[model samples]
Target chain A: MPMRTVRFLFFLLSIAAGIGLGLVYGWLIKTPDPGQLTPQVLRADFKADYVLMVAQVYQRDQNLAQAVQRLSRLDPASPARTVAQALLTARDLQYDPADLQVMSDLSRALQSLETPAATGEPAP
Target chain B: MNDNESRGNLYLFTGLILGLAVGLLISLVISPVEFVDIDPSAMGEAYRNEYRLLIAQAFQSDGNLQRARERLALLREADPARSLAMQAQQLVGEGASPADARALALLAAALTNPQGIAFTPQPSPTLPPGEEAQTTREVGQAIFTPTPPLPTRTPVPTFTPRPTATPMRALDAPFVLESRQDVCDGSLPAGRLVIEVFDRDGNPMAGVPVQVVWGQNQTSLFYTGLAPEISPGYADFQMEAGVVYTLRVGAVSDTLNDLSVPACGGGVRVVFREGR
Candidate 1:
């Protein structure tokens, strides 16, 4: 029994194996891509970006029902409020008011939306 | 256990610990999480442009340097002047159409030194060709003269009194904040803050008196809709951005200092499962 003695060597070899395993795991889990910004990473610009997305969606889709659904995810006070803020932000940013006419249309469309009370407010 | 068996167990434990430590070290160097170095020059390109434009517009409206500097600082630009110059050049280099020529010109105006003259974007097309050329010439003068020359004046001009202008007063604002969905001093304009009160049965309560107050005893009182639709347990009050208000409803009271962003997108919400 005194034989299997080199306990340190056994421990060292196992440690080495663990290190190799860790490297393998690291390679498998890819990191973020360069120049690639996800919605979560771009949290600071999300508010402004949200408005732009809404504008694009509103323009291409041109449907009030779907626009409201998409906008509701933004957690705005209301869809109309988001539109109003977008208009003001656009104005403040000096974007052409004419280009934001759709925002005004979206604003009107949101008025007919069944109020938050009907659907229940989204979770904070 | 035998000595050999006991020794093997110890070795295994040691190996596991060492392996984990080595692997962590290797991973740290060989495969770290990706992180791109962010700089103001590269990050939020659209947002930066828009913000710079806002600064220019605000400067136009107020002609206030201290305020302008404070706002531009938000862009994280150490040298806003340099940043503005590059943006102007970028705009012009983009081969902007004649319609966009003014915006390019505005960038130049923002970059101009000795900003004493007022700048109004979208120059009048009615300006005669020669006059417009002359105006451009003045801005061109600024592009080269990094260190602007001091204004030359023979003497203090005689003061001519101009008529004083009246200031626009904000309407008295009042709203209840005890319930959910109440906000104060929000940075954006939402519409009027509408709070709908409900009863124990989850039905909208009408004719509930709500009081809103701000600044030294000024108060406005209104009852939630007398009828379901009118008050429908719902009441709205006009609120100005950047002001704080206190609300009192049936002994439920709280403070709201959120700036309005548009109706209540998501500033305040008081949960009322057991609606009082």
Candidate 2:
């Protein structure tokens, strides 16, 4: 190949190598703190525990609005769905039966909230 | 040709450096590493508070100290009890539900001196028919015991009662005023309502909630043992000189009225001993 063509190819190769190094540094060497991260990235077990907590509090307070408010932090679009997901994870993890029962209570509560009849409003 | 080769090498080096900068910006700012399936240890400060609150509430619901301890370990705090206690104090100041603050404080107290406290049975959700309540698990209780202020301090209270499975409020231990001393010293701050709490045995208790009410039902709630340097079970409030205040320790304690700061530019000290 001509010297100019060869030089251009070398430049491209160098650029690719630089990009790879930069990616490694950013993604691995200097990652953000786990404690400083959002809940969306939480492990399945932690998410399940969080849901159980909401359930436990809901059971005590019996306030659907407050329960929904707390769950909305985990999944804004559908807090009920988040509870359901947590129930599944809790079951898979073989959590204590009492804990599972509380989660189920919350899931049922959230499901009731999503229903139109429970809210005294017509379905959309 | 030699000069041309040197120029070509310089161009390649420039391209590499330029590409590296672009990649770093894209990775660090534009498209940073996205976290997935992370544990509680990696949660942000606010979420960590939420997590701590959840642990305390769960403990309240199930009365599971060991489980709560295990969950709290995920946070990797150097002193989990201290963190819970501080959070409890903050929640009380923020006007959170008394139950929430009490739960955190209960857990902190449980962790601090497990042997000295007893927990009352908290009501649980009704179980399904035929699914007997799990009675095998060892339940946790909620009363906090005071630690002595110093090695040479007064004799610690004797821990006697360990009530079983009785349903009671978190802070049901009734305390009565043991003594009230008015100090009119030039050294102390003006209008300070200094209070100390002890068990029936004269042991100084930590994490006792103190309530002060004044001026048409205006109230301020605070906890003791926050400032360990002075003494555990020691908490003070700044009182307006003219306003008369009522002081109560815990839920069932007898309210003490006419507790105003003495006019001598000093503080008043009140000692409470558990009546039961």
Candidate 3:
């Protein structure tokens, strides 16, 4: 091979090696701190369990406002949306029928809260 | 010729360094690994606190200690009961909702003493009159059959009510002063008032609120179980020498007067137990 070509090939190989090392370091060597993680990143099943917990609390306290506030921590987009997603996950995971019931109850309550506002009627 | 070869080698080395930098930038900044399925143990401090709170509230709602323990295990705490007690105390200190603090404390107590403890039902918040029935109907509609039957999954045992189950003792049962003793140990803290609370069955009860008042109604409130190392149902307060104090446990406990550092120079130990 020509001397110039050989040098060029070596340069490209070095770059490839460097990229591999960088990927390893970034992906494996120095991952994000676990303590800094947010609840939004929780596993789908765990997220469902968390939603179920809020539902249970609501069952006892009948406090819709507090339930919605707690659910918002897990998913900021919407509390009702969060519960609906959790209900689906719980069904797929075969969560206890009682637990599924609780999540569904929460989903319905949250939807009810939104319905009045969406329909341009004064909230009941 | 040697100098040219060295220059070429340097160029290759530079290329490698440039590649590494770019790779790290991409991996760490632009497209860092997103955590989608982490367990409770890996959660950040705030989320973990929220998880613990939820666990406590669930325990309160259902009165299930074993389930609470299993859920707490997900947090991976060295001492789940103690962690809960400390968090409860901290929550109370921070002036958070009394219900929330009480829920945490109740769970901590249950973990400390497995024997059943009666808890007052939390007052349900009232909703608008028209919406109450609607909410109830929605909750009633949630009972449905599972779409997929998993024959492999073992059936969960149904909870059976025991006809002869012993009635649980109320957590707020009036507490009577059982014993008062003066400690003379030099090693122990001076002028400290150590209080221990117990249930009727003699099991140490955790999370009973102890109140101390002195000098024109200046009061201090603390809960038991803060020092699980000594005992789950133990709490202490420091008393100034010659300052008289009155102490009480729970909401309906009889007050004991003239509580002060005894002349023996160690401290006073008071034991309280549930009364009929």
Instruction: Choose the strongest candidate by TM-score.
Output: 3
Model 1, B1-276: lDDT tens per residue? 699778768778777777867776666564454332122233346546744644443343333343344445545666675565455435434643321222222333333432311222232225344542111011011011112233331111111111121121111223233345545466323546566655555544433445668778877665443222232455566666556666665334444444343344434433221222
What DockQ do you compute for every candidate structure? 0.14, 0.45, 0.44
**Candidate 3 per-residue lDDT over residues A1-124, each given as its tens digit:** 9987988889899998888899888877887676688777666666777887899889878999999889988888899999988888767765657777777888889998888556667767
Off by over 4 Å in 1: A1-124, B1-68, B97-101, B104-108, B111-276
lDDT of 3 by residue, B10-52 (tens): 9989989988998898788877766655568778887888899
Residue B164, candidate 3: alpha-carbon lDDT? 18
Q: Please write out the lDDT profile of model 2 over residues B1-276, one tens digit for every residue.
A: 999879878988887897788779867877777666556766789988988988887666666565677778777799898898788778877898766776777677667655333453333445567864322122121111122122121111111111122332344778889999887865557888889887666666655789999998899987765544455567789888888999998778889999887867688889998777
lDDT of 2 at B202: 68
Q: What interface RMSD, in Å and to 1 decimal, does model 1 have?
A: 13.5
Scored against the true structure, residue B145 in model 3 reaches a CA lDDT of 20
Report the TM-score of candidate 1, chain B only.
Answer: 0.28
Better of 2 and 3 by lDDT: 3
For model 1 the TM-score comes to: 0.29
Give i-RMS (Å) per prediction: 13.5, 9.8, 5.5
User: Comparing 2 and 3 by DockQ, which wins?
Assistant: 2
